[model samples]
Target: MTGVVRLATRGSELALWQTKWVVSLLPVPTEIVTVETEGDRDQERSLTEIGGQGVFVKEIQRHVLDRRATIAVHSAKDLPSTSVDGLVVGAWLPRANPFDAIVGCTLSELAPRARVGTSSLRRSAQLRALRPDVDIVSLRGNIRTRLTKGKGLDAIFVAAAALERLEIQPPVVEILDARVMMPQVGQGVVAVECRADDREMIQLLSALSDRETELSVLAERSFLRTFGTGCSLPIGAFAEMQDGTIMLSAMVAAPDGTRVLRGSLRGEDPEQLGGLLASDLVERGALALLSASEGKG
Candidate 1:
């Protein structure tokens, strides 16, 4: 008798949308169980203070561990760097745009010192690098909230995938090139997690895993782990496979974006290639800016 797979996720519109998309591709029946996460509870606080990368994922993971849910679905970018002992990532779905978009009220817009709202330091820093005159401010909430409250800021920055999922046409979206604005590790990918011993569920999800996204995210995660930067750090990485070789680009910056260190490395081995790229950046003084970015000495 095949049991139903209970997938745990936050109840946010985007989160549920992602889960439904994954479930659509699977053969087995799925039951969605919404778990309110720390991030959802404290929408006013910065993610770093509320619990960092795992704030949204921990609750879903807990549901799986407690046997209340057979699997957990999460935005791959929000996952913790270290793998949990009791669970395994059963799949990494094919990625989306994986780029930041600058959205404004009009395509032809110009307001010096215009306020720009964003929750991520990575996006803020990259925007500063490109347009230092804009005033960057912290804005956190679901897509609907942010867009509704977009009154104060002249514009905002958000993931392209999120906007597309919502089916809302951003008034104007300036998509930054990946070479200029590297994405966070695992961005635009969805991860399905299950208890390591759930062989049946694992086999089902394994079929949905995208090998290219898996390898690329693996490399990006390795790079981030080696650097030891948290979500608050002004760091970004993006990796891709090019003609059977892995190429990784990464950056570390002072929070203010006044100083930044960027570099890349390539190799046949994605993990090793990422480490080499991170090490090269470290050797060339990336640690200095990374430390400052993290508010460390």
Candidate 2:
């Protein structure tokens, strides 16, 4: 309803797609303002090597903080556990698939001791949990690159929503259910960020917010924040709404995925439930795993 509301977004194809999708839900005229963040330009480095997944969101957040844009859109998983100064999550849209998909090859058909490409500690840890025999390697770059380089890989794990959004049709070997491998906190969700005190913007975004998705991810993210492991940690967490109850599962593992601890908690309140789930995991030795793992942001 306002004169061209500027929306800040990263230049990645996936990020653009997410931004455009969110924009479509808005009633006001929108001007998509793309910014090339460091993560987009540096394809040679791993996300952990740069600034973790935050590399993809920091620049766009800058636009919001600087008042260049009314809001910044991001894949919630890419954000840091800590909230940005001067900004807050105004809205959380409905989540997409939060499960990790085994692509290029099915998990069963992959050769013994087969090389699997993935840079996510979460994925690596989960894969190791399922099949400790497989080799895990750091395969960086975008989804397209990983899939292309997956020629030698028995398989690669990626977010199912991403593959679907990109219209990728790799014979997905298997879509690992969250019960097997909990997803990263905030995975499969998009968050709208705006100035914390901007009542107008907050109200606009609230219209798009889905309460169930918000509560579920809130619990998941709270669990992550409680653990104090940022994006670089080999941490996987996911929460689902079942019968009006939120069931959360989470796990933490060593970089090699040899040491892992997992647990679950269920409740109605996202933050409280997530905290309980995290405590259960910590009691099961998650803290020790985080302590041993290097580069756990």
Query: What digit string (tens of lDDT, one per residue) describes model 2 on residues 156-264?
Result: 8888888878888886657778777778889889999999988888999998999999988888888988876666778988888889999888888876678778788
Candidate 1 off by > 4 Å: 105-110, 295-297
In angstroms, the error of model 1 at 229 is 3.2
In candidate 2, which residue ranges exceed 4 Å CA deviation?
Answer: none
Write the residue-wise lDDT of candidate 1 on 1-297 in tens digits. Answer: 287878899999999999999889878878999999998999888887776769888989999999999999999888877788899999999999888777874323748778988888887777677778878788999988998777677988778789887887875778777766778888888999999998888888888999888889888888888876557677888888888877888888776778777888887777787788888888888887766765321
Measured with C-alpha atoms, the lDDT of residue 44 in candidate 1 is 83
By summed lDDT, the worst window of 10 consecutive residues in model 1 runs over 288-297
Candidate 2 local lDDT, residue 71: 92
lDDT of 1 at 153: 78
